[model samples]
Target: MKCFVAVLIIVTLATDAVSEASVRTCEPIKVAMCKNIGYNQTGMPNLARHTLQADADVTLQTFSPLVQYGCSSQLDLFLCTVYVPMCTDKVALPIGPCRGLCESVYERCYPVLSEFGFQWPAELDCSLFPAENNHEHMCMEGPGERTAPVGTVTLDSVNAGGRSACRRLIKPNSWVWVRGSSRCAQFCEAEVLWESGERRAAEVWLATWAALSFACTLAAVGAQLACGDRGSAGERALVLVALCRCAAAAGWGVRAAAGRTAAGCAKDSTTPTRMLLAHDGLANPNCAVVFLLLYYFGLAASVWWVVVAGAWRASVLRPSVTTSGTGTRNDRHSSLLQLAAWGVPAALAAAVLVTRDVDADELTGTCFVGNQSSKSLLALVIVPEAICLLLGTVFLATGLRAILRRPVPVPAPTALLTSPPQQITDQTLLRLGAFAALYAVPSTCILATWVYEYAWREDWLAAPVPTEIPSTQPRPAFWVFLFRIFASQILGVMVAVWIATPRLKALWRKIAGPRKPPLTKCPAGPPPTPLTLHCYATHSHSLSRSQMHKYATYRPPQQHSYRKPRHYHYSAGETIL
Candidate 1:
């Protein structure tokens, strides 16, 4: 019994000693773990490790059954190898041969871990690796450390031994890593990769609409010009509006084409990955400038043209106003309207060009006045457009109301007899109101959507993380964007339809040809009437009145005696004796 007790005590001591030794060795292993992942004395691996570990724990704790189980199995092996001296030392044997093996292990493990929402601690981040050796491998920097150049590091020149070592530990193509020099670059690349079929469909839709709008606007402009002297001031203003729409649509089409090229390049798997890394694939500055100029000009011009049309309509409707003898006034108004419609937008665009950095993207491939964050875009572009649209709408509404409510003059009874009374039907009022509403709808929709998006930015930003590969655009934003595209692009078509009125059609016909008057013929029954006979009396000498009377009396007496006997009657057409 004494011998057995002694044997048990000895076994207990041996087990305790082994555990103590392991505990002591794990301290160094922890420190070496940081170093193996490229952390140095300057790097606060403990802090990064703690923070990342907490995040990982939260992620794992909240994970679904399948993910939790799969991750648990993988992490068990990883944690065991990390904590145990024997396992760690076996992997790091012959440090030179194991260098690549260590890197390969980290590379292969990180993506799998990330898939489970486990971000490796910053200390283990390849970006934190020493700058001197950045070309040798991917690295992460310590907090406040100077950032190393990204994409400068490549594995192309790695020695055969290193490749062999890495291959022995990690399967071929098991992990592919890309390092960008800047976070912006990485974000840009991720955005390109994250682009889905929906966005592509949206682009195609926008492009098609833009093309149609361009054609329609061009046709409207031509038709309006063809009206020449017959076109009303309102029609002329609409022509300007249509021309602006054409310019804007053309710009959009061109911009979309550029974006399509970039998207095509991105979608091509055969394209070199290095080429895709640059910003050129996203936008071109030169093309952006042209697009922005045309787009903003058109946008501003359209708003101001509405203002001009409203004002002109109001002038024409006012009882006190007469267009007669107002040629100078009309010309001045036109000049001012032209200045406002074209000049203000030009000035604003110039200001944007000078004050802001314009950029283009696959989403809005025009050189718009802001970057991806769109920090000043609302203020610069959308706000002015909104204000103009609002003002124009107010002007339109006021003018239309004034025109509608104005008392029609009662015709005098005599005037009514001479000409029929001019009718103002309910249908005419309804049509006018509908036309005004149609003009306002597109701008109003655009402004409303923009406001909604702007106000709801926080909600959009705070939306819950998606379980699957997240979409680059939120569903709400995508729908809103699609709506805006449709509204803006369809304006030209609406205007074209609106201008196809009977009056314009009549004017077109008149311009084509003028009518001829009917031919007349004279009557044919006037040959029997010889109303007067011309007789020539020649006298050799002039006689006094008494002598002429005596001669007449004598001749008359002789003729009377003869005529009494004969009693001859002469027709009124013949000369009497």
Candidate 2:
């Protein structure tokens, strides 16, 4: 019995010693403002998350202006407890403010940060601290924390997190910090980070518009098909362009329709609390599918746009062997056009896949390359997009110049006009202009929006950190996202408009209106046997003697009757299916 008690006593003493010695670097609070508040000893890596005492003092010093402004009476204790957490023999883990205390201070002080174009610092995330002082999760629940009078700070209608913070604040099912980023930024998997209906509405809008775009592209392709080979070289190339648009719109439509599911979102390799898309191409199966459709097909559509413009320029500059289709040059360019439209995007997509540039865009909930990475955005999107526009623009401008320079053929004044049919009406010119604008305008706008996003990406990745000057917090514009969704799909609808011309309508009617009954050849047969009739002289009652004798064997004078010829037809041996 005595031995058993002695061993038990020794074990208890050992546990107490370990607990007491847990804080090795306990020392006096070096921060000036924090010294006057209750607790004296502090541990390293203060709650402001400064590692060194000197650094902690400096960061806390920056907040002196707000402390002086008196947002909260408890602000001093709150700041010190976090920046210089309580360290003592009584407690092993440093004692930081309770979640309630942290939230209270946050509510008061975030407004001040807002004024200076800042967000609530991630270091002081209230959720990171303990809920209450307890054995397992100990924290400093300040005396009468609930009973303490609240501060005079105004909590405005604006969320204290500000737009950038609010935009990024996702309630993720699972998350990891975006790889290579220092801030607590997460790549969410499975949902969009929307705080209000406005954001949700954007997603719905994209899906609906994309569906419309798909329908429009189908209409354009349908019209082209119905017109058969009658459309010009430019219009023919437009058929291919419309087909590409159909594919891209379908991809985007898939993304919008999926709506906050695993298919559209991706994982960030780095923060647990936050989820952002990491650059891992084809890592998610749905992401891979979307990438091919939007990137490969979208790029293909742009290349085809270049082909459309180039065909127009060729018609004006090279004229044609005949106006029926185009010059021989067009036939020669067909192989090159196919290579450009398909092969180039395929190569680019292969590169993006190997490099894993695919990322899920937050605003649209669509997996695409360059949504979260600036490098990917610049290389994969901005550069290629700009180059496509540049080429198309050059072709369009050259073609316009050619058309304008063509000589006008004034009718001769004698004007009996040895007339041949012509179709150079003002309406035709207007349709051409509208077609060119529709093609170029949406493309240019999309590129411009991409440039803005590329510029805004770095700031977006590192939120709550004020990189910009205090005067402006240039948050990534919500309109940029909305515009991107609209412009990306509007090209397809515009193509439909271009195809809705009177010319195509007439051609459609001619091809699909009514097939005429085909003419057939007359049958080859022996000539009609001569109709043999021996004419006997009419009874000579009224005839003279000589006339009666001469006419005796002469046929009843050949009597002719006028009537339409009987037509005969022979089948060509074609079997209708």
Candidate 3:
């Protein structure tokens, strides 16, 4: 019995030793391929008992045809040929078949090897296989290979011959794989259709908002113009602002319309490219130029006009300042404002044209500076506008503080009694407050969006496939989209509402037509007294005697005495005598 026990122990030890040796001797590529398919190395001992070399040799021989068609290595050939065909049964192509085959191969090979006193290894690395190599070519390996069904469609087919359809369908960073040419084609078509619809929707949204903004700005400008020179300096500055907003809105609308028909440049579907150069070739450079120039000019002018308006209000609100030299000061200030509003933008646009390329992009949905040229835009346009907005905000805050801090006159009691109390209206301050708040909305939105884009610069420039399709995007992306849309498209309308005033409304009424004033009649009164003859003669130094005599016949009414008689004392004295 002791000898039998000792023999059993020796036999078990030998089996373990043999399993370890066999596993160690297995080719690294075969082990990797097996693991890549799905065989865990923990069960590799079972696989080790199956003569791994012989099995790999046979698998290679069976799929040798794939190597001739540019398969990168033996593992690549095996994945494309032996594993994919065996597990799929030639039905629909399996998703990530190489991975599926790995799992399937391990399951089938494990049980057979376990019968021989071996188990699969647990520590083998399977990720070394070049799964990214084009697998579509392997589909043509055998003589009776299947083809896509008739009436099936494919996308990006123009460059389909160069790269694997599977690789194209599954992005490099992504790991999910779809199966079958028909299904893959359908998936791709769905994505394409969704992207096209999103683009069209974005265009329509931008155009519609832009048109509304343009109309509102026009109304604001008309109201200001109708006021003529009677309007306040701040109101006049607002006219320029409205004009700028109108131009900006019109430019955005034009951009949206032009982008639909403009096919700038064809992108290389195979190789990765920079976002700026990827779409720089403009078919309609003229339209691009118009939109970009107008957009920058209008944007800059709008901000500066706000500054001008704020400054005007600040000056008007100062107590020590008189209205005597206001006309002269306004003339000078207006000239400077005109120069800054129009000239600064022109110079910036010209600089951009000279030093950088202008291009349209999905971000703005309009022609503007290109991605590589974005720094210039930041320096010339964005930075200046931000600074102006900041300064405008400060001025507005100061103006508001001044308005709030202004002392309200306490009427003296006697003064109130002697004169009617005058009504005091803080209309100017209220208007200023409204303008400040309205201007801040778009400016703040713009600044916030800029920060968001800068922080996520890689996400923006990565140019992800079907980038505009919102369904697959994360939550933050949607917020960014909303921010951009609201900031860029609603400024004019908000400004219009901000500047709408009673004076503006009255001006509009006058432009519509004047109304007639109601007629006022005098009230009836007592008749005048006739002159007396005696009085006329006494004062008639220039009157003739005949005229006096003619008037003397007129009699005057007699006067009656109201006093009592004083005869009591005299009557008493007479009676005593």
Candidate 4:
């Protein structure tokens, strides 16, 4: 108990630290572009008209209206003709002027128009516009001329030429016109603030933590199973539950991966490799994986509990009983029959689950990891189980208490001379009753709770959104979500460890283990065994001397046996029969 408490405290402290670290170290996304939209056609001249129309639709639906419809066409044309040329004015440019310039205008300005769908574009080129580079706004450099050290004229002078020129070009009632130019800062500085090491670390941490959690969960479950001596029924039920959980978890992982893949593809359609790479680089899959792992371990604990219950009954309670077709009942092999009943159903269920797939969508990256099948199965199996467990526990406790409290009776000397008939004792009866109740009640309660939780509502037992570290949330009102985890998993594991430890096991054996059989009453050793004999004398079945002779014909008769006996006459007063 002390060890468990200490470990829990350490884990809690670590988790708290992690949560605090997340708050401090993790950075929020800047709400940058996530998607963009544009015409699919290529080499379409005068794209400004279509672009303006698209922008108009996007603007009306999203941000406040910046320009009226009558001026929309003119604004588009002016942007295409003026902003397009000015931005691409580098000497000896690789992509060329008009440089698919309409594409650049669309890419730079789409984020502002499309807030929800504006995503980052793949290529840095102008051609990768509306669909990709959906930055909120375009950065337009001020007109400039610079004089080099050799007195060669250049556009580097911000105050004298570039700044004044840009200020003079501003149009009335325009949302995009530049107000001024700063010599010390480049126009590109605003968007460059996005790239950060902290963001990358956070993503990596989430993914790694999720993976680790899942692995640990699986390990814990497997460890529990390995630690116990479980019979076939328990083994079967556990396998069924585990397989279902695994399948569902796989489905969810696949779904998460699919979403990531699709997002990546939409961002960089030209490069399939990048999309695939991104698919492999996400966090939610880890969380789903860990959850599945926990399910596996939880299943193990439940199976062990069932095993213990069954074993306790077989060892301490139910007396062997047997029945024949006739009035007399047989008392042997009853335990064997009971064991068979539990084993058969469990074996079948395990076999079926092992052979069959839970669902068909895991491979498509759309369904496997977070699928609902396992949780559904849990709901199916837990209710009856919980009820059975609780009832059995109550029955056992009651019987034990009754036996200890009952008074003993004294036997008379005459009665003590004869042994009592072989009949079941009150203690034996109580053990059977206790076993039945304990085995049934708790399992049923648990099963019911699981069903209610699963079937009640979609988000009734919602897990926190995926994160890099384990998080602590305040207690939820739902008993299924909170108490079960704390009791059945955390507390259960601790209890099992405490009970199963070598020292505890030794102590228990000393207290309640089997003892040597009592000595027999015969002072001398047991006498030679005697063969049982049966004799019958009836009116029609008495054996005569002649009959004895006939039956013994093969053997010679003795002289006394062969001779007929002569009897002496008795006096009338003294009668001889």
Candidate 5:
């Protein structure tokens, strides 16, 4: 009976050895286990391991079957995924020196899958080599029944191996058979291998956005340098330049987006399995960076143009009070003309900027309004913007305050009175009045927006975006509108127009017109001929009658005189006689 038991033990060990030998040619997946796989299997075997890849495309994979076992904690959950290409795949590739096929293609994992009654025999297929072998050679095998108990499996670690050999082997009809026990393994491995070309495409997209961004920066800076001043014609030219730049930038953006989408479609067309996971990390960065920067710069420029308009208005209204003939204050009308020209463009630019964000959906790229990192960032942009617009309005108001108060010039009664005052020119008054009236509307609107945003409530920024958009706090509505406005340079053209208008020239012409002669009575005929008169008093001295007569007739006046009234001589130094 003892011999029978020993024989049964030997036979069991021999069967186990043969089973191990069956899978010797196929290398085990090398995975670092968190929990021992054989601790508590319900008569099932644990086959957790790691696989390594050779190409630059495939990354890493892990597998953990513990999820099915109701293991809740990280320790209880084993992480397992697939590694592409077997050990045989590496040996077939062009390997580097120092590191052979295995080392070059993949990393070796330790603590082999020996816990589940598995033995990695040092010498595998020893009998397969038939050098000097007999027909029946003696051999021994281990027990078929394993004594090791199954335990809960846990995921311990994951390491990135360079790439997958399977990726290099992937072709038209290549099929990867996944072991069903590990769920995440197949998908993870497949993505890593298939994403190489897609990643390169994404890099190209990013490069294009960056190029467009830099180009736009140059164009903007150039435009500012070229037409920095106000006036309708100059502003118009500048606006046209700005519009060109914006259109170019927008064009680049559109192309980039199309390229990205096309690349995704192409990938999908070729690889039916890659349809759901089309969007990758590579394409996102370029799209976001280029689009946002362009949008912000463009918006900033727009806001600047509006401010410029306000500035122009303020400037026009500055010389409102001038010295009238009577030392009184007088208004200039040219200010109003200047204001109207500048303010209209500014207001229109603002309106455009405020409304542009509504069309942002078609342009997947992040623009000024849609791409705030946090609520605080959005607030930071909006509050300052609202304040700027507010300040501009204030400037306009202060400038225009005296416009309505200008006194009607009192017309004089005489010909001189009827003529316009020489002191205060009609051109000057017209400019002042024009500036005050025209700027009043837009500047007031700016002030209103500012009040609504920064003052009406704490939620001043709420006007820009809809209430339904999720937010931790209110965001100013100006941002969304400003983006589209900024993107277009119509304001710049308007500025040019303001600087070079027919009215502006006309005002100057009216100012430079010939001056009318000052009021004066015609010079009464030429002054009286130079005549000498003498008045002689018939006094006591016995002077020549001729002298007395000379005194009475034509007196030559003495240069010096004293009021010695007792005796008076009108002309001669000698008294009466």
Candidate 6:
């Protein structure tokens, strides 16, 4: 019996000695970079199983670039705590950072590292760690809770609401939201992956079209000025369309040249990340200016298209009996068109600014309204474009109907070659129709894209596809944006093409032609007079004087008398030249 008791005691002592031998000791840190890790001593072998501090310090050097990249504010701390864990003799094992900490740092910095062709280390699997610091299973919360005793709090739900709101505003397509950090950024903004070329292509495409559009519109406007065609109110309204297109297209280039850094992409922390939540207004100067240039001037371009079709001429054309009323009515109509064009766009842009709805497009890389929130897209872009298109279409149909139904004038044999008083042409009507259709098609396509964006925005966010995926197959939406980009440039090119009448081309040729060589000697006579017809009539004829200038039948006079070759009548007080 004594021998049995002795055997049992020996077994107990052996088990205790084995456990005591296995106990890990806290060792002083030798790593220079990890010195600030809350505690000086760490348990060995660490999460990486580096037995000595020197070994741990060496392995950690591999992650130096990620730490320096500054993706997460807590990256350095997380890395240090992971390699050289906090150790105390009071506990049997060392404690490492929580899974939450690892995940937060991993998500923020992974994309940055991936850009360099690095993969996340297998040893640092976040799923293997504890979720939070607690008595039952202790782990670090983060820097904020580094000094706190274990078993205290969890940061899981702290940022949930803010992150959710940001997700909605971003409406990420070829990008992802990293809300773990204080700032939520699009994944591609921080790191361009294998699909970097696609993003770059978008920027270049927009910039290319913008340059083309700008030149086209400028040529149209300059042609009007150079040809001396600005006198007609219809031509004046057409010029306004060209001017607005120029301004709007110029804004498109800003985003292309600057790429993702341009306006509508403000990342200031002082600003709210969510559009719907930001009633305080967008404080970004660039964002506001670009918004005004693109939306305000773009809408104005559409508005002026309506005026070009029906308003200007309808109000100004008179029966010649009441010519005095034309000026007052035309001026009033002009004011109303200006108000609808400039004032309405200004009001709408102001509303967008106040709501802070601006965001960058992934396909175009240009900052524009309604790209972020589908609600904003519906309210600001779709509605406005639809209304303008409708108004322009209605005006165009009525103008065409009136022109087609007009009574044909019976002409005197002498007046066979003379044009009727009305100046509306088949060519003019076609241009107006072209302009409206151009606006309508693009606007309709854009509305379709937004519809797709709206329908899929949430589903996409719920299960995000890897935005930087490398494959030839792309989403169907990509082609939709491509069409949109291509179509937008079409308007400017067509406008310039349509307005380049034969007369305009002749004027351009005259201006571009070599200048007449200076006269070798001073002319002894005044330059030949233009408007040989107008030289005799110092003033425009009044409508009441139409009968006075009508052609009369000619008769041969007596042999002694001289007969005028042309039977032209003169006003009562006019000089016969």
TM of each candidate vs. truth: 0.51, 0.55, 0.50, 0.27, 0.32, 0.53
lDDT (10s digit) by residue, model 3, range 372-454: 23444467656766877787777777777776787876768776664432222245545655776677777777767765654
User: What are the per-residue Cα lDDT tens digits for candidate 6 across 158-252?
Assistant: 23233332333323232323342322335324322224667667667778888999998888777777777544456577778778888888888
Write model 4 residue lDDT over 97-170, tens digit each, in one string. 23244453343345434532444333324442332212333332222223123222111122322222222321
Model 1 over residues 1-577: C-alpha lDDT tens digits?
A: 9999999999998786465344421123333222353322221112123323334334333323322222122232233222221212222110111223334445545654565466665433433323332434222221221222432222221221222222222122221221211112212233431255665777788889989988887877766666654343555566667777788887777667666444322221112222232222224455554446455756665665565546555653553544463445656687787777777787777676564334444354444553222444577667777777777677667767776787877878776654532243234334444655577788788778767756654333332334787654333457777898899878777776665554468576787787778877767886574444322324445556675455444343454342222123334476522
Q: Which stretches of candidate 4 lie over 4 Å from their true place?
A: 1-113, 117-289, 317-452, 455-480, 497-577
Candidate achieving the largest lDDT: 2
Model 2 earns a TM-score of 0.55
Off by over 4 Å in 1: 1-195, 262-286, 361-367, 414-434, 457-474, 500-504, 507-577
Q: What global local distance difference test value does model 4 have? A: 0.34
Q: Cα-based RMSD of the predictions, in order?
A: 16.5, 16.1, 19.1, 26.7, 21.2, 15.8
Question: Residues 1-577, candidate 5, lDDT per residue (tens digit)?
Answer: 9999999999998787566444434334333342243221111122222212221112211123212211122211212111221223212211111112112112221111132233423222122222321333211121121111222111111112101211222220121211121111112123322245544544464445445544554554444445443332223323433443454355445535555443222122212333211222123444334344344444344344344445444434553443342122112433453454345444543443443221111122222332211222234344544554565556556655655565666765674863565444445435433533443344344334434433422232122333776755443453432333232323333333433353445555556896678998767787645443444344555656775565446555666854222343354333322
| lDDT tens digits by residue: candidate 2, 1-577 | 9999999999998786565456346888877888878878888756664668998888887776566444455777887888888887666667888998888788766865675567887888999999988888788766532221222111111222222222343332222222133222334533333344655788788888899999988877776676565456677777787898999998987676555556555553222233345346465787788888999999998888887777666656764345545555567777887887889899999998887667666555577877756667888888988998999899888878877898877777654543432344234434554476568998898998888876655544333433556544346667777887898888888877677565466676786878689998877996554433332333334546676455445454345733222222334433212
**Regarding TM-score, does 4 or 5 come out ahead?**
5
Backbone-clash count (model 5): 81
Worst 10 residues of 1 by lDDT: 89-98
Candidates sorted by TM-score, best first: 2, 6, 1, 3, 5, 4
Q: Cα deviation in Å at residue 258, candidate 4?
A: 22
Model 1: lDDT equals 0.49
Candidate 4, residue 130: how far the Cα is off, in Å = 23
lDDT of 1 at 439: 74
Question: Cα lDDT of all candidates, in order?
Answer: 0.49, 0.67, 0.49, 0.34, 0.34, 0.62
For model 2, the superposed segments whose C-alpha errors exceed 4 Å read: 1-175, 178-185, 189-196, 267-278, 412-421, 424-430, 464-472, 501-504, 507-577
